[model samples]
Target: MTDPANPLVSTEWLEKNLATPDVRVVDATYYLPVEDGDARAEYEQEHIPEAVFFDIDAIKDDSNSLPHMLPSPEVFSSKVRKLGLGDGTRIVVYDRKGLMSAPRVWWMFRVFGHRDVYVLDGGLPKWKAEQRPLDDHPVLPEERHFTARFDTTRVRDLNKILGNIESKAEQLVDARSAGRFEGRDQEPWPGRQSGRIPGSYNVPYTNLIDSQSGCLKAPDALRRQFEDAGVDLQAPIVTSCGSGITAAALAMALDILGHRDVALYDGSWAEWGLSDKLPIEKGPEASASVSTER
Candidate 1:
C-alpha cells in the first residue's frame, strides 16, 4: 500500500477504496507496434469493474506530425469530460503491462493542472493474479465537468531540448535501450536515424522496472539504478523515450525520489531520430560506460 501522502496507490488499496465518490479508475493501456496486441480490444474484453479506457493515442496534438503528441487544453478538456473525469476527481491510472502506459496518463493529467492523480503499482496483471476482481461488461459513468489548464512550463519542445543539448542547462535522460541509444539498433519506426542526443545519459526504462513483478522498484533501488547509470538525480532531468510514453515512467520515478524539476521531451527520439541534422553521438561518455549517440 502507498502512503496516504504519496501519489501512488497499490491494487489492494484501490480495491478497498474504489467505491469512494471522489475516486476514478482509468485503464490507460497502450501497446508498442512490436507487441502485436490491441490495447482497446483487451480493455473491452475485461478490466477493473468501473474503470474507463483512456486511449492515449487517440487524444493528441492532431495538427502535429508527431505520434501521440500532447493535445491542446481545450481538446483535452472536452475529451476527458466526455469520459466522465471531473475537476475534483482523484484518478488512479493503470496499464496492462504495469508501469508502461499508466505513467504517461498520470503525467498528462498533471500537465493539465490535475495533481490528484496516481498510477496503480503492478497494474492489472498483479490485480488479476491476486484474484481481486474483474468485469467484462461495459461501464456506464455519470457525466462530470472536466476543466483543463495546460501548463506549458511542464512540457519541453524540440527546440528547447536542442538548446539544452548545447547549453547543458538540464540533464538529458534517454529511456531507450542502450543499443538504440548508441546507434547500433534500428528504431521501430523506419527512416529514423539511430543514435542518442549529444550529452544525454543512457538509462533504459526497463532498468527502472522489476521484471518479475512488473512494478517499479523501491526508491532505494531506483536511486542506485540511476547512480550506477551515471545520472545525477540532483540535477534537472528531461526524459526521452522512443516517443514520449515510457519517459513518463522515468519522470514518475524521479518524482517519487523527490526530484522536483524533472520534465519530459514530448517529441523525444521519434522526432530527433527522424531528423538528419540533429547531432548524434556513438559510444558512452566518460561518466558512464553505456554507449550513447545523437
Candidate 2:
C-alpha cells in the first residue's frame, strides 16, 4: 500500500471497496494463441464479484490487420459505454494469470483519457487464493456515456517507430523472452520469423513481475532490470511484445518509476515481426541505436 494511488491495487483494497457504486471491475484476461485458451470461457467460469469480461481481441479495431490494435475514439467510447465504463468511473482491471494482461486494459483506459483506472495486483490468482467472493454470472451493465479522447503521444505505430529509429529520440524496449529477443526461439504465432526490432533492448515482461505471487516487483528491482537491459530512464521509451499485450506491463513499470514519456507500440512485434520490409536483429549482442549515435 505504499502508493495508494498507485497504478495497481491489492486484493485487500479491492475487497474493501468492492461494493463502491462508482467502481467498475473489469476482467481483462487474454491468453496467447499458442496457449490455445479461450479468455471468455475462463471468465465465464469464475471471476471477481461485479466483474465484467473485457475481451481484448473483440474490443480492438476490427479494421486493423494486426491483432488488438487500438480502436478509434468513437469505437472505444461506444464499447466502453456499453460496459458502463465512463470517464468518471473508477475502473479496476484484473486477469486470471495474475499480472498478465490486466495492465493492457489499464493502459487502454489511460490512452482513452480515463485516468482513474488501476490494475489488480496479483490479479485473479491472489483473489482466489484469499477466497474472496467470486461470481459466475456476468453482471448486466447499464449504459453510460463514455467520452474517449485518444492520445497519440501515448502510442506508437510501425511508421512512427520507423521514424524514431533514425532520430534516436526514443528507446525501444522489447518485453518478449530473451530467446525471442535473441531470435533463438520460435514465435508462438505462425509464419512470423523470430527476431527483435533492431536497436531494441530486451527486458522481458516477466522481469517486472513476481512469479510466485503474480504481483509487480519492487521499484528498485524494476529499475535494476531496466538498467541491466540498458534502458536509459531519462529517454522516452516505446515498449513492444509479441502482440502488444505484455508490453503494457513494461509501460506500467515505467509509470511506476515516474517516467512521463513512456509509450506502448500498439502494433508491437506482431506487426513488426511479420513485415518483410522492417529490419530485424538477432543475438544478445544487438544493441540500442542510441549507443551508436552517442
Candidate 3:
C-alpha cells in the first residue's frame, strides 16, 4: 500500500488499486502555448481506465489573465465536486507527458486542503511502457460534496515575493532551465523579459526527475540536487518556474525530502517578467550556504 504521506504512487500501485471504491484517478495533462498541444483531445484518445480529465485551464481563475492560476475556494470546490472528488476520495493525478503537469494538480489539491492526494509516479508514459491497460471512453462521475479549506501558507503572491526581496526570510528556488533562468533563451511569452527574480537559486526542475524513466529521483538524490544548488534544506523555500507549473514539482520534491516549510510562487516568471518594474538578474546564481541536515 502507498503511504498517505507520500506525494507519489507507482503505476503498479495505481493499476492494483484502480478498482478501490475510494480511489479516483485524474488526468491533468497540460501543454505549453509554444507546444500547441491539445491536452483534452489527447486524453480523449487514450488514458488509464476510470480516469477523468482535470482541465487546469477550465478550472482556473478566469478573471486572471495568467494561465491556470488557482481559483477561489468556492470555485475549486464546485469544479472538483462535479468530478466526484469528495472528502473521502483518494485522488491520483497523472499527465500525458510523464510528470510534467500532474504535480501542479497535486499541489493544487493540497493547497485547497485535500490531503488524500498523490501524483502517479512516471505518469502515463511509464504506464504505457509497462503495457498497462488504457481506455478512451468518457466517464461522467456522479457529483459529490467537496469542501475547500484554502491554505494560504502553501502559496505565495506577487506582493509577498516582492517583499521577500528585502526581508530574505524565505529563499527563492527557481525550477526553470539554466538557459531561461540565465536569460540566454528568449522568454516563452511575448513582451515578457528573460531573466530570473533577483536573489533566487536555480534548481532546474529537470534535475529532480529521471530522464529515462520520467519518475522523480530518490530522496537522497533529490536532497543532493538542492544541495548542489546551494539550497538550505532546513530553511523555508518558495519554488517558482516559467508559469508556476514546474515549480510544483520542486515543492513536491522538497516535501518528499521531509522539508516541511515549502511554498510555491503562483505567478512565477510569467508575472515576474511581464513588467520592467520588477527586478531580474542574469547569468549564474550567486552561491549560498547549503544545510547539512535534512
Candidate 4:
C-alpha cells in the first residue's frame, strides 16, 4: 500500500496499485526548450497505464507572460476536474526524466489544497529500467468534481520576493545549476540574463536525487545536502528556479525533511531575470546571512 504520509511512492507500489479504483496516475513530463523534446508526443508513445497527461504549460496562468505560473483556482479546478482528479482521489504524478518535473505538479496540487497527491519516485526512467508494464493508449477519464481551495502560504509572487529582499524575513533558495546561478552559463529562456536573486543560496535540485536509482535521497541525506549548502533549517524558506519548475523539487525536498515553512516563488528567475530592474548576484553565494545587499 502507498504511504499517504510520504510525498513519494515506489514504482513497485504504483505497479501493484495501477488498477486501484481510487488511484489516479498523471504523467507530468515537461522538457526544457534546450532539450528540444515534446512531452505530449512522448506520452503518446508510451506511459503508465491509465495515466493522463498533465501539461504544465497548458494549465497555467495564460494572462501572465511568464511561463507556467499557477492558474487561478477556478481555472485549476476546471482543468484538473476534466483530468479525473478530485476529492478522495490519490493522485500519483510522475515524469519521463525521473524526479525532474513531477515534484512541480505535486506542489501545484498542494497549492490547490489537494492533500492526497504524491510523486512517483524514480519516475518513468526507473519504471522502464525495471521493465514494468506500459501502454500507449490514451486515457479519457470521466470528469470529476475537483475543488480548489487556494492556499496562499504555499506560493509566493514577485512582490513577495522583492519585499523579502529588504525585510529578509525568509531565506531564498535557488534550485538552478551552479553555473546558471553564478551567471557563468546561458539561461534556458531567451532574452533572460543569467544570475540569481541577491541573497538566495544554491542547492541544485539534482543534489537531492540518487544518481543510480533516480530517486530522492533519504531524509538524513537531504538534511545534510541543504545544511551543506548553507540553508538554515529553522528559518522560513522560499525556493526559486529557472522558471519555478525545479524550485518545487526543493520545496518537496524540504517537505521531506519536515520543514514546514517553505514556499515557492512562482515567478522565479524567469520573471526576475527578464528585467534588469531587480538586484542580482553573479558569483558564489555571499554568506549564510539571509540578506546579501547588491
CA-only RMSD, every prediction: 3.1, 3.4, 4.8, 2.8
* C-alpha lDDT of residue 131 in model 4: 99
lDDT of 2 by residue, 1-294 (tens): 225347988899999998888889999999888897898998888889889889999999999878899999899999989988986788999998887899999999899898889999998888999999997986898989998888889999888888887888899999999999888899987878778777889999988888777789999999999999888998999999998899999999999999989999998888877867777777756444212211
| Candidate 3 error regions (>4 Å) | 284-294
Q: Per-residue lDDT for 62-150 in model 1, tens only? A: 89988899999989988888788888888999999888889999999989988889999999989999999998999888878888888
Q: Per model, how many backbone clashes are there?
A: 7, 0, 0, 0
Higher-ranked by TM-score: 1 or 4: 4
Reference-based lDDT, residue 233, model 3: 98
Candidate 3 per-residue lDDT, tens place, 1-294, comes to: 668779999999999999999999999999888898999999999989989999988999989999789999999999999999989999999998888899999999999999999999999999999999999999999999998999999999999999998899999999999999888899887778788888899999889999878899999999999999999999999999999899999999999988889999999999988877777777744323211121
lDDT of 4 by residue, 137-194 (tens): 9799999999898999999999899899889999999999999988889998988977
- When 3 and 4 are scored with lDDT, the better candidate is 4
TM-score of each: 0.93, 0.94, 0.95, 0.96
lDDT over C-alpha atoms for residue 215 of model 2 = 89
Pick by lDDT: 2 or 4, better one = 4
Evaluated against the true structure, the overall lDDT of model 2 is 0.87
The residue ranges of model 2 lying beyond 4 angstroms of the native Cα positions read 1-5, 284-294
Worst 10 residues of 1 by lDDT: 285-294
